[model samples]
Target: MGRNIKRILIIGMSIISSLAVGIIRTEAAEATSSFGSASYEWMQGIESPIGVYVSSDTPIYYMEMIVTYDPEILQYSSGGELEEEGRIKVEIVGEESIEVSQMLYFVPLCSGTTDITIENVIVQYESGETAAVASTSAPITVPLEEGCALKSLLVNGKIIEGFQPDILSYTLDLAENIEKVEVTAVADSDTTTVEISDTSLVIGENRIWITTMNEEGKRAVYTLTVNRVQNLSGEGTTKEEKTRHQEVEVLREEKEEGGNDIQRIVFLILAGLFFILAVLLFLLIRISERKRRNRRRCRAKRIAYQKADLLKKVRENDRQKEVLNKTSEIEIDVQHVTMIFKREKDEATSIKELLIRTIKRQRSYELFKALDDVSFTVYKGEVVGIIGTNGSGKSTILKIISGVLVPTKGQVIVDKNKIQLLTLGTGFDFELTGRENVYLNGAIIGYTKEFIDEKYEEIVKFAELEGFMEEKVRNYSSGMVSRLGFAIATIRDTPEILILDEVLSVGDMFFQKKSSARIKEMMNGGSTVLIVSHSTSVIKSNCTKAVWIEKGRLRAFGTPEEVCEVYEKMNQE
Candidate 1:
């Protein structure tokens, strides 16, 4: 019985000790799960320095950090969830390490160093326990002075405030002639220095470089081009030499007639002078007649040449018409197409009024008729040209036919033919690289990736952008963009129905000629084409038939010459 009691006591002590150790471990875990300490630092921003960022290692479900700042030295303008007096509450969610940040806005009233403290940091855990963590941020230093920049630029004693620093160049037009232009640049700081490349102006475009450098070694350059026009008139001559020759001639004539019967001698001399003057006058008349006849012969030759050229063009046009009439098929037909646009108008000035008008449907709108029952037919192997003035619905008609725009009341029957619209600068992304944009444009035009891959090198070569294929299109010049667009639209695959809208007018002369030749080749290859251009010469030379639209109405549809003649007469009227 003594041995049993001793064993039972030993077991009881062991159990009690185990229970105490488990309790102590639970307490230690609870202590470790409590809110941890935090530290913060300052970061720079655009308007002001960013405030303290309080970071804690404990996984927190909910947290709120309050930042206390000196109102005299620093003032909060924005950021943080809630702001009241000098305290800001930043609430963070999720079971992760917590970081709370706010912007440190400075008060412009005073500039100095001040302490920004983080206080009242409350962190909550998943066990529904909340505790406050103590933290503080570093002091912020604010500069009392602003940075240096160009404050103003003066040209010829006149301040030019309209010049923008972002524009690297400026042009000044002066109607009055000037030999020199006086330029002065003023900086925000007195420590900045200015230099000018040239002070005098010359005829034509004169480029002057104006450079400004701050004390910190930051430099900015501006180019000023001054143009001067010079006067090219002769000066006046003196008057004394004009009268000496007349007095000498009179004395000589009086001496010659002195010893000879003066009246008879004067009569005889006058008669002979009259005969010589008459002969000279007759020869001058003959020469003038001969020159007039020569001019007429030259004009006749020119007219004959022009007539022969016209006849050749007419014959070529006739041949094309004959071939199209015999071998071509109908491609597109438009029957009484009409389009109208609804333009909404709202004069509401305030947000409240705008909301009220929108909710009550009180806005007014008007209908604008862009096309009025226009009709035309296109055939394969024929080139049709549409000509009209601005706002006469020429482009609108093309858009409708190309399926870019649907008519308001009429239907366009394309007869299952593939059509593509080629316009300058359309269907291009300026931010994408030229190579990527080529593929993108090809995809947009219904070409597959495989086809684009095959034609990629050819497209780049045709555009003359071999080395610039990897460069962004925004960096390209307008002519370069135009060339790339034209090359992509014309190469590899030719659509059955092609619609061109003033695309030929873009780029340089060489590109224009290249594009025109490609278009002619397409037309010759039996692709139906519809073109719109403001150039009458383009219409007369390239098109077999012309359609004239005036103020949303079809005025004439016939041969190019006939339709152009009628359109010209109407414009004259």
Candidate 2:
């Protein structure tokens, strides 16, 4: 068993060694072929031959090669002139040749037949002269019949073809990208049949095997690979080629104008500009129309309001006349009425503190001059509306009249009329039930418990919260809350002078109409109404006279229409 194992191991080692030696020999043979072989070819009468013929299946249009010798026989380098060694003067008269009639003959010198030969081809080393001996003395003939035709797919200048043997085998350099390829022998129409493998190939380096085909199969195979390299010329191609391409482009665009990419890009840019312009124009027109509509609506509302104002003033005039007629016999005395709010000075306070404070003194409460040097008198049973933009002391005047905020400079004298501030749900608790709140609010508004109890059913019915009375007030919607508030405010018997601070604007249109009707009803009952509103239309419609406040000062005081006109014109500027 041991002898059998040893024999098998020896056989395996021998096989591996032999295979390695064969591979090395094959590689060496290929390397020798790549550099090519130089041998003398004996002719019948020719002498001193210098050039050799190299034939391939592909056509040899040109050849650029470096001839390297053993340095002893022919010591030569390319580019520079040949450096002759010993007594040998082997010169290449011309390295180029063209085939005429399937024969490569020498170029004629003057009028005589030129022999392809080298003169005095002698070899003289350091010792003496010795005639050079030929290593290969047979005629070296690479038949043109066996050469391959090398050509490019396109005749354009982009692809340049030449010989390249930078590998173990000779090949063609396609110095540009090949979109498609085909290899054929004897042309397409030739009867002298030749064969190749894989005629069509992709755009890359590919091997094209050339061989002769018999009736059975293939023979005499010479595998030659054609390398298609990627060569990019960034000069935007040649002018002639670019012009031809441009002509094709123009024709393409003419055929399919809508599909032209350049035209499409241009069309898209134009369309975007037009779209932006159209949108801007539409926006401008819309804004202009809105402004026009607002002006027309404002004017129409203002005119309607003016008519209502005139009617209110006429009614107020009639009431004043009736009051004067009733009290003609009673003598009313005029007395000097003055009002002021004083700010006390502190000895310890500095000037900076005085500048920062509303009141100049540290010891005194801050006194803001809300209604400084302001005075107004209302006749009996007269209705007035104070119209102003935001922050014009309109609410301050209402507050002063309601006694919620004492004025720094003002006096009020109501002979026999009771003043009441009409606000929306002034005193109501959110956490408590509506029923509990009714009792709490009634007491706060200076009403007795018995009076509230009598009005409880009417308030609940008017607010429309019959079953919701037991529920917490916070649970109600805004509209429902406002409804309850309006009911609570109007449940009272009418006061002599009503001080309303734009509370009717709290709810939606339905509630606003209801509240307006209640206010009109109060005015009809000979109650003096003093109202404040930013809405000039509301003031003009509901009040007998209007006062315009501007920048914390009285700008104008007249009939509602007249004051509102002045305010509107100033706002337009």
Candidate 3:
């Protein structure tokens, strides 16, 4: 029984040992380590002076290094020599303090890499005599990243030379047989970024190949450059003796897996909510679009019916007016036409003063009795024309008649069933597309949305901007905008009194002739029309009678020929 137990124990121990060795090999395979270098200094003594760099011409005996390490290792050792351009004496003050006590001369190097090292570092010994460790520091690179090119190595203060390259690529000459070759690039400007490939360089003269590529697949070749640095006399330091100390920081792997599952569940829930929201939004948008389309269809039908009714009424009134009267008659009755404009206090003392100043001081505003005791009446179907110089209130009169502006003092009375004030092209929001502005202007013209929808295609065709209908009115040429505006105004089939405001100025000869014919058709259909123009040709060609307005007063009101003759004579005077 004892022998059997021993065999079992031996077998179990061998198995355990084999498994432990296998696990150790696996862990080692997965382990990784990286190497880098830092710089430390040696003090001359506990109170001795150190050297530093300053912009002054004065010599500096004390220095400082931007070093890393907590309570840095400071000590003196015998097995070290600083690889500098000059010789420097190093002394140990405390048991762990190291420093340079004597000044050293330095030789300057021009081109090529220099070997800089600190030797004679005294460390702990296991079983050998005079055991020491070598601490290597990177050679100082000058001119930063863009200035100098480093392409060589140094070890222990000597150039251990005779190096050749396997591949020779160059912006400059290179040595051969480089090892632990690490090539790095640093940039001064933020415009470009630099990337380094190799970080290990061997100690020796070497020939290296360097390649640079831009974002555009453009390649540039730079010669592996080696710059020589001779001024290594910054400070000489003795190595500090360190006690053989091993510290195992108790790092407990918490294996925090519970919170990971919770985070995954939260992410899944959020993802599901987003998906549901996206689906809901899509459905809502689709429904809204459908409703908008239905409303547009209904509006179009209503507008069509209203346009037909307006055209019928206009025809019936035109017939009634033409047959009832043959002689021209005029009656003016304006209860009171008052216009008020707001003014800032700084502008003028009072409203009356502000008005006078506007007329004289600012020449842009012309004061006029836009309509003074203005009240008028004309026999049925009488054609009237209004003429005035720029600021003499011709447009103001039309705007009042069209109900776009209200008089501050009086009431306007018309014998006609309805008024059609043809404003030509005005009051258009250029930000909206031509098609969109059509509906807006239609509504302003007393046509329902339904009517605009019914004639939408016809309006676009008349404007001849079929392809550009959707383009913003701001983008339209002046001619295109005028045509579109004219098309929208005239397309409204309405009323007894048709008022025309210098609308014939736009369009070519063909369009003018076409518009004239349309006017004649409306007139013959018995519509009472009021025509306003500075053009004698339009007045004579379209109006049976005319009214000339000069300086906010009626200059002439008679047949077109008689009125225009008076206008010519008045202007000549």
Instruction: Compose the digit string of candidate 2's lDDT tens values, residues 368-447.
Output: 45454334445556678888788777777666666566545324444333777767777888999999988887777777
lDDT of every predicted structure (CA atoms): 0.67, 0.52, 0.50
Among the numbered candidates, top lDDT falls to 1
TM-score of each: 0.41, 0.37, 0.37
Kindly report which residue stretches of model 2 are placed more than 4 angstroms away from their true locations once superposed.
1-367
Among all candidates shown, the one with the greatest TM-score: 1
Q: Root-mean-square deviation of each candidate, in angstroms?
A: 47.1, 50.1, 39.0
Least accurate 10 contiguous residues by lDDT in model 1: 28-37
* Candidate 1, 1-573: lDDT as tens digits: 344544554565455445544433222112111111132222211123343444555455566777777564455654464376666666655423354333334332233345566677777764566665657566555432232245777799986647754444567865335778889877667887777787777677787766666665545555666776443321222244435555777888888778456645555555555455456545554665668768999999899889866865776576555635653476776756889999867578998998898899898899999898676667666799999999999998888887779899656667445877877666789899999899888887777899889888988887888899999999999999999988888875677788888877768898788888888887777778899998878999999988988889776666788777767777789
* TM accuracy, model 1: 0.41
Residue 549 lDDT in model 3?
Answer: 63
User: Which segments of model 3 are wrong by more than 4 Å?
Assistant: 1-368, 374-376, 404-411, 415-417
lDDT of 2 at 170: 38
Query: Tens-digit lDDT track for model 3 on 471-500?
Result: 999998888887888888888664577888
Better of 1 and 3 by TM-score: 1
